[model samples]
Target: MPESNNCCEAQGLDAITAKSHMDESIKPTEPSLIQQVIDNPTGDGITDTNLRVPEGCPRIDPCPAKAAIQTQECETEKGDGDNIALERARNAPPGPLGPVPTGHGENVPLEYWTPLGDLTGTRPAVENFSLSRFSPNEWNEHNKKLSAACHDGIQVATTAGFNALCSISRAYAEADRNQMDNNIRLSTRAGTIHRWTVELERMIADIIEEIDLVQEVRRRTMRVKSVLQVVENIDKDMMRIRCFRMDNDLVRDQVSEEVTKELSLCEEIRDVYIRLLDQIKMQIEELITAKRRVEFDWSEKKEAYEIETESRGLGSQSDTILWKAGSTRIPPDQSSPSGYEYSTKQVLAEGYTAKQRSSTLRVNVDAMIEKAVKDLRDQADRVDLTLTQQIQLQEQALRRLEAELYKDLQQLSDTETLIDEMHDASKKLDGAMKCAQTRLDKRLLRHGVENCRDVPQFGLIEEVKSLSESVSATLGQLKRAENSTSSLIQSRRDIEKEMVVKRPVILTVPYYVCDRRSYKSNAQLEIQSP
Candidate 1:
């Protein structure tokens, strides 16, 4: 205490016992971000016991006339306690209602008043000074020479201190949370854009091979070559699956797996159909050749039998049957030479019997030829039906492919649009950042620091730094979108770095409301460190 030269005067302690801590003379000021971060919640510098606070704390009466005055030796033992400064600050003018009417202009608050206790040194015109008229009375009635109004010794009322601290702390904490959330949101958006761009570009690259396959299939499909009257029904399919990505990883995996499986099935079906068509063509050709052979031989034999019967005075026996249209086979029969015919029919009676037997043979063979032709027609019909079904299946597959391709195309279109939007935002942010940088450079130059490192940073410098960081992050994201597949985790780290600026944001709003005031050049106006 060292005699506590800065102790509250007896005349100035009355308001601490009567009014609010936020006195009119002491307007609320912004909470200092630095202070809040450092101010421990453990306790204020005071006794822990509640009982020792408002009432039981030692009374600091500086008045020499007070009956309970402590000895000088007792004051020398307490050391230089800050309570001396606190008490003086709490009770000094301007009074709680505002500036007291001094013979001079208004007196400034003690905290900002220079030279530690004398205000007349700064403003020589002020006359009714509080320092000159010290008194033991609340109204200075002990002398009745100074003003009756006075400030309080309590910076905060004991009963209301807890609530005020809690409210202010909450406001700062809320601001911190909001700023952190904004940083997180920006990171998430950046990551999403990056992931989509990478995925889309990869898909577009992969699609080249699929397009080639489709073209190859198209070249071979439905083509009949080399005079083989063979019709081909090849299944041609191209699968393209494009989808807009979301944050749902599990869903994306499932969709990707499913699309791959279905496309594979389409290729397998195409292969099976191609093999089936080849087999069917070979089988049909064999059947058709057999039928053609049987028809030709039967026709030759039937004509000979009818001629022999007519010459023997017997009625004509026309047992010949022709092959049906669209026959898939040819007969293998050949005409018999004259030498063989005569050798087969020796002696007149034997020849007549042989003729009858020949007629029977001709009829039997003709019926066989008709049966072969019927079989060929039936097989061809069945193969045609099967081929048609296969063709229908192929067409259906093509349609499904087109649908998927359409979706892929739509996804590509959407991704391109998103990329464009990102570029536009990047350009806008770049321009704004450049402007902020110019302003910062000018400020630094004015402060005689060409480099930002040499200057002491304030709100403007911090704002510029913050904008630069945000711009850099966006540019990084755009770069990744255009050409890189860098992990988005880096973006998250960038966001965390950005969050460092969030702390000061907590006190910014309150400062504007509580500390903001118009410029005043009055000698008594306090010069705050804004």
Candidate 2:
């Protein structure tokens, strides 16, 4: 077996040498183990042994002679027992523990094996053992690294979640704040509206109050006007009465006329004059009462105003009182004795003096009597002057009354004619009133009011003036109130607008991120649960 192996080695070397020379010009091609085995089966039992050859060789195509010889030789060698040896070598258990079956051993080059030893058993158990054995620990370390990475991812995810939550919360807060701001604005508007409304109401109330006061003042003014009108009418009637009184001859002539209409008219005029006088007297009394009341009120107001003005240092000097008789003085009286009284006084003095002694008497009786006379004359002249002044005043008053009486008489005649016409008109008016009253009564009866004729006839001119004045004053007051109300409303609108137009601002807000890729990259975990 050793000899056969040696001969195979020698033959392999020769074939290598021949092939090397023959392939010098051709590209060298390495053979696989299977191909080497098929080409040189008889040369070596191990097909992967390196074939040796000489350095130089001729390219000779040896014919069938060398091939037949080599074939016979190979046949004889196989018959000798090489087939059984090759079979035993192929089937033999790998030596010792044998070559570990490395999964890629078939891909190893057969040329890499040696022919001297059983390299099949001697080859490395695994030619290229993977680093997989150490991989478990590496994988564990990798897993730990991965776990750390996953932890970081989870932290990132948590951070992203927190940031997202913060953004959402901020948005929600902003929304809430906006809503709150809106609500506050609305509330503020409502408050402003309410305040304006209240102010308007108060203004309206003030206007109403002012209107009421003005209306009341106007009503009193109307009453005063009516009273004044009545007074004027009374004055006219008094003048008519005076004129009638003055024209006695004319009245008498008219009274004696055949028609008797003037007489009847004069009677009616007299009666109307009397009624008018009474009415005028009553109206005058009322006016006087009213004037007295007004005067009293004015006096009170004036007094109060004066006191206030004085306190305020606004008083007038014209209010001071003065007297006209400040310098008048009366002198002492000097008088003279009568003649018989003087003689008696002298006899008494002589008797008294005869008893005492014979003495001459010194007397100033003449001067005393003269002074008395002068004093008496001055007093008489002063009395005469006073009496004369009083008489002049009386004469002036009487003359004025006489003139007034003459004017009154003249007017009285004219008024008598007017009165006649008025009486005739009154008769016609009475007829009309009766007719109207009858008609009204019929209508009133239909409306269930009985005895409608009991309704009094209204005085025309008096009521007409009173009513007209009342209506006029009332309308004036209404106009003033309307103006005041309009002004108040405009003021309220301005106030409301000002209130609504003023508000405060907000600051310091955050922004949010909404990119999916950034969220995923930063996050360790998926948002959707695995």
Q: After superposition, how far is residue 303 of candidate 2 from its true place, in Å?
A: 51
On TM-score, the leading prediction is 1
Taking all chains together, each candidate's TM-score versus the true structure is 0.23, 0.19
Per-structure clash totals for the candidates: 16, 10
Candidate 2, 369-405: lDDT as tens digits: 2332333234323433443453354356445545554
Name the best candidate (by lDDT): 2
Model 2: how far residue 193 lies from native, Å: 3.5
Alpha-carbon lDDT, every model? 0.37, 0.38
Residue 530, model 2: lDDT of 15
Error of 2 at 113 (Å): 43
| Candidate 1 lDDT by residue in tens digits, 105-220 | 11222332221122112221123333333213323443332321222324346435877888889987887777567556645544443443343333333333333333333233
Q: Which stretches of candidate 1 lie over 4 Å from their true place?
A: 1-359, 445-473, 476-530
Superposed Cα deviation of residue 57, candidate 1 (Å): 99
Model 2, residue pairs in steric clash: 13-52, 17-53, 153-524, 242-408, 243-408, 243-411, 243-412, 243-413, 244-412, 246-409
